[model samples]
Target: MPRVSPAHMEARRRQILEGAARCFARDGFHATSMQDILRETGLSAGAVYRYFPGKDAMIVDLAHHVLREVAAVFRDASLAERPPLPDVILGDSLTRAADLLTFPPSLIVQVWAETVRSPELATVLRTGLNNLVGHWRVLVEAYQRNGWMRPDVPAEHVARTLAACAQGYLLQSALVDRQDVSVVVEGLRGIMSIDAPTTQGT
Candidate 1:
């Protein structure tokens, strides 16, 4: 048998993951079987199994992969000499995530739903959330240093809030109405523009 190059192996792995993502996105994770993935990829059962042992492994791997890619977008933006504002950073990150994922962004809704039944998936999601939040914290601190954000507010709090905003956007996009990235970004900017009224001791 001819030996396969590392690049070829990586390509094969990606092919399997992409096919799996499509199935998961179209049907819920529980509904997508190994046979479905094999059929989608047009690869033999042996070939698909060579990369992922089962659907659970594929789900966890896919979640991690998507999260890392999304986090990278924020990481790169945060490291810029003149980092953009929170809204711009978020809009860009979400946009990049939507573009990069082989499946619909709404697919995340199904993954989150599955976490209730799968501890492994839940753990992977928590880790991924932490990783993404860490990058958001960096971005928040950068904003404060640049005087774009109030220094009095805790960076950690702001970071989590930003994460929540992104989550809410995804949930709404999936469950409610599909809105453009700009709409959410504009809302963030509007909220940021408001000046809180001073509260005297009462």
Candidate 2:
């Protein structure tokens, strides 16, 4: 038996995950079956099973991928060379939010809905959220040190508030498309004292 290269293995795994995401997006996770994923990927049942044991496993991986992509956006924004203004950060946040907002809200909605029923999925989400919050807390503190943000508000409070705001935006956008998110960003700037409202990007 010949060995598969690491790159090939990773590519194959991503292919399965992508197909699963599309299926879940089209149909709620509960409604999506392994066969549906197989059909989406154009892979045989055996091939699909080789990568993911079942639908539950596929959902878990898909959810993690989504969370990680979101988390990376925050982490990158935090680490950028030029410090980002609050409005700029907010805009960037929305842009990232929009990326996850893709067609068929059911993808995210399904995973969110599943947390109540699946302890395993719940843990994955919780851990990913905690890590994201931690990153934001650090960023908030950095902003405070440089007087870019208000010092009166606690860093943890600010981070958690921003996170909550993002989730709220996601929910609203998922329900009704084309919402004017600038107002929300302006409100956040006021709360955080993110100066230079004109600042566009990092």
Candidate 3:
């Protein structure tokens, strides 16, 4: 047999993942089976199993991949010479995430729901959340240093709040109301425009 190159192996793995993502997005995780992935990928059962032992592994890997890509977006923004405001950074990050993921953003809702029953998935998600929060903290600290944000508040607290806002936006967009990401950024900009004094003068 001819030896396969690393690039070819990676490509094959991605093919399986992409197929799996489509199935999971179209049908919930529980409803998607290995046969469904095989049919979607047009690959043999042996080939698919060679890359992933089971659906659980595939879902976990896909979740990790999505979170890592999303974190990288925030990390890059935080390292920029002139980082964007919290709202802009989040909007950009979310936009990047939606574009990068092979599946629809709505699929994240299903993954999040599955976390309740899968401890491994929950742990992976928590770690990913922490990674994202770390990057957000850097941006928050920068804003505080520049006097754009109140210094009295803890940076971690602010970071988590911003992270929560982003998650809420995702949930709302996916479930409650579908709107452009610009709408979210614009709303945040509006809220930040009213600069109230940290302490009222006597």
Clashes of each: 0, 0, 0
lDDT of 3 by residue, 1-202 (tens): 9999999999999999999989998987999989999999999999999999999898899888889888888988889988888877878787887787767768889889989989999999999999989998999889888887789899999889888888888888778776688888888889889978768999
**Model 1 Cα lDDT, one tens digit per residue, 11-92:** 9998999899999989878888889999999999999988889998888888888788888888888789998888888898
Compose the digit string of candidate 2's lDDT tens values, residues 1-202: 9999999988988888888888777777778888888888899988888888998898898778777877877788789766676566667767765676444554666788889999999999999989878878878888889876669889999888778887777677667775667867877778655354645787
| Angstrom error at residue 84, model 1 | 1.3
Q: RMSD of each candidate?
A: 1.9, 5.9, 2.0
Q: List the residue pairs that clash in candidate 2.
A: none
Residue 190 displacement in candidate 3 (angstroms): 1.2
**TM-score, per-candidate, Cα-based:** 0.91, 0.81, 0.92
Q: Let me know the TM-score candidate 1 reaches against the reference structure.
A: 0.91
Please give the lDDT score at residue 106 for candidate 2: 42
User: Which is the winner by lDDT between candidate 2 and candidate 3?
Assistant: 3
Q: Which whole-number lDDT from 0 to 100 does residue 127 have in model 2? A: 97
TM-score of 3: 0.92
Residue runs of model 1 more than 4 Å from their true location after superposition = 199-202
Residue 166 error, candidate 3, Å: 1.6
